[model samples]
Structure formats: structure tokens, C-alpha cells
Target: MLLAVGKAAGPEKTLTERYVERAAKAGRAMGLTGFDVRELPDGDGPTRADREAASILAKRGRGVLVALDERGKALTSEEFAAFLQGFADDARDVTFAIGGADGHPPSLRQAADHVLSLSTLTLPHQLARVMLAEQIYRAVTLCIGHPYHRV
Candidate 1:
């Protein structure tokens, strides 16, 4: 699952949806069910981050929670594939979270099973989703021995 604070407006939404659909289709061969996204309203004010954090946390299920933040451990594509494979091996769900404009609160960041840095630079939440969705598609391809992620 991919959960973000706000909906992607134009091209970002199209790209995200495209990648998610690709991942889901590829994932079926790997015994994966879905690659879905949930969009929440942008939290406002000084408490926005915390409020969004609460909302994201509330939606967290038995899956692994991965928070996307700048201050996170960066992983290579292969390493990320292994990380995901470990969860899939255990038949677990994984939720990749993207926060509001203010980014994730410390609570959500700390509570995440793994904190991932998409890039060293900060990104708009929508673009982050697009990036994440593409990575997910790539990862699924890698997992099933597809050539989509050729080096």
C-alpha cells in the first residue's frame, strides 16, 4: 500500500497510477494481491505534521510501515529488493508512507519499521509517490526475474 497526505494533481497522479498498475500486474505472478494508494487531506497549521502522522499511523495495519524522509538510510535498488523480499517471504503487507508539506512527524518517523530516503533532496509529496510507485514496480520486476530493472 502507498499512503500519501494529498492527492497528486496532474502528471504526478498519472505516473503514479501507471506505475502502481504495472506493479500490481507484475506482482500477481509473485503471489502479491494489490498495490493500492490511499490519499488523505493535507493537514494544516503548526500541528499539521502531527495530525497527518496520526492519520497515517491510524491507517497502518499489520503491514510494515516505511516512512519516506530525507533523514533516512538510503538503500540501493538491490538492497531494497532484498528488504522487500524478506517481508514477502514472511507473507506480510508493507505500507510506504509519504507525509504532508511539513513532512512526517517524529512519531511516525520513529515508529516506522524502516525509514527510507528516496533522495538526499526534499521532494513534493506527489512526486515522491510517483517515484515510490516506480520503484515498487521495478522491485516487483526484480523479484520475479523480470528485466525491467536491468543494470
Candidate 2:
């Protein structure tokens, strides 16, 4: 599960849909199930983030929450694949949260099991979704010993 703030618009939305489709196909090919995304309501700043974080956490039933934040730890593709393999081995659900422009609130970051950063630079929300989906697909391929991830 992926919890994101704001809705994708125009071409970003189209690209996001395509990336999602590709990610799902990749996951299926790797025999990994449950690749989904959930868009949350948009609100003002930290307060909105707090509310959305609460909602996202509430829906997580014994699942690990991974919050996306600039301040979070960075991992290589191989590292990420190993991280995901841990969850898969344990049969645990993992939720990746993407906050709005104001970024994730302290409450949300504190609540996350793991805080990960896609990059050091700031990214538009829509583009982040596409990059994340592709990374997920890449990770799945890596886990299955697929040549898609060439070193």
C-alpha cells in the first residue's frame, strides 16, 4: 500500500497510471502480490499532514509503514531489494507514504517503521510516484534474480 497526498493531474496522472501498471506487472511476474496506491485528501500544512498520517496509520493492520522523506536514510537498489525481501519473507504488508509539498509531519515520521529517501533533491509528487514505481519494479526483479537489474 502507498499513501500519497494530492492527486496527479494531466500528463503526470497518465504517467503515474502507466508506471503503476508496469509495477504491478513486475510484481506479479516476481510472484509478489498487493501493489496498490491510495491518495489522501489535501489540506493546509503540518496539520493536514498529521491528519493524513493518522488516517494512513489507522488503515495499516499489522503492516510496516515506510515514510518517504528527504531526511530519511538512503539505500542502494540492492539494499532496497534486500529490505523488501525481509518483509516478503515475513509475509508482512508494507506501506510507503508520500507526503505533500510541506513534507511529512514529525508525527508521521516518528510512526514510520522505516524512513526512506528516494533522492536528496526535491521532486514533484507525481514524478516521485513514477520513480518509486519503477524502483519497486526494479527491486522485485532483483529479488527474483532477473536481468532487469543489471548491477
Candidate 3:
């Protein structure tokens, strides 16, 4: 399940929803089931919100926790593919948490099984959500031997 905290603000509402919905479609196309998405209230700061989101995700299931952070490790698409494959093989589920504008709380960073960086540059939280969804979809396709991923 991909859990994103904070409500979509102004320009981000439609785009974020569109990407998430598309991601779900892509997942279905690849026969990947149990794609769950939960959106939490936006906390005042990165630390507070991340902690809250982490708590919510912890209750869901026992799986790898991947936090999307700018300062986290960056990976190539192929590397991401390998990570996803390994994660699927070893865990019952993979939970990805995306924090809001100010970024994730330190507690979340500390608790995450893996901290993934989309890019070093700061991106709006809404766009990041969409990008994360798209990447998840792409990763699923890559893992299932779909032609969607071009080398």
C-alpha cells in the first residue's frame, strides 16, 4: 500500500488523483493486486506528520517501509526494479510513505526500512505524489516482464 500524508493543495488536487488512479490501473493491468492508498491529515511540520503517517502505516501490516525523501538514497530505474523484486519476494507487503511540502519528519526517516530519493531538487509534494505513483506502476511493469519498461 502507498500511504501519502496531507491533503492535496490547490493546483495539486486533480493531478495527484489522476496519477494515483492511473497507477492503480497500471497495477491492475500487470495483475498486481492489493494496491491500497491512504491519505492522512497534513501535520504542521515534517517531523510531526511523518511520525503520524509512520504510525498509521505500522498498524497496517508488516512489510518494508520506504520513505520518499529528497535526502535519501537515489537509485536508477533498474536498481529500483531490483529493489521492488526483492521486496516482493521477501515481504508480505511494501509500504511507501510520501510526506508533505516541508518534507518527512526525522522520526519517519529513522524508522523507514529504506529512504528513497526521487531527486535532490525540491518538488512540490503534490507532484511528488504523482511521480511516486507513476514510478510504482513502472516498477510493477518492469517486475512482471511487461513491455512497458524500455531499457
Candidate number of the best TM-score: 1
lDDT per residue, candidate 3, 34-123, as tens digits? 575677766664367656665556654677788899999999877887887786666457888887666777777888899999999888
Off by over 4 Å in 2: none
Ranking by TM-score: 1, 2, 3
Per-model clash counts, in order, read 0, 0, 2
lDDT by residue for model 2 (1-151), tens = 7788888789877776776776677777656686887888777744886777777777766789999888999999999999988988888888898887778889989989999999999887778887787788778888888888885
How do all models score by TM-score? 0.98, 0.90, 0.80
Window of ten residues with lowest summed lDDT in model 2: 23-32
lDDT of 2 at 151: 56
Instruction: Judging by TM-score, tell me the better candidate of 1 and 3.
Output: 1
- For model 1, what is the alpha-carbon lDDT of residue 133? 93
Best-to-worst lDDT order: 1, 2, 3
Superposed Cα deviation of residue 68, candidate 3 (Å): 0.5
**What's the C-alpha lDDT at position 140 in model 2?**
85
Q: Model 1, poorest ten-residue lDDT window?
A: 79-88
TM-score of 2: 0.90
Clash pairs (backbone) in predicted model 1: none
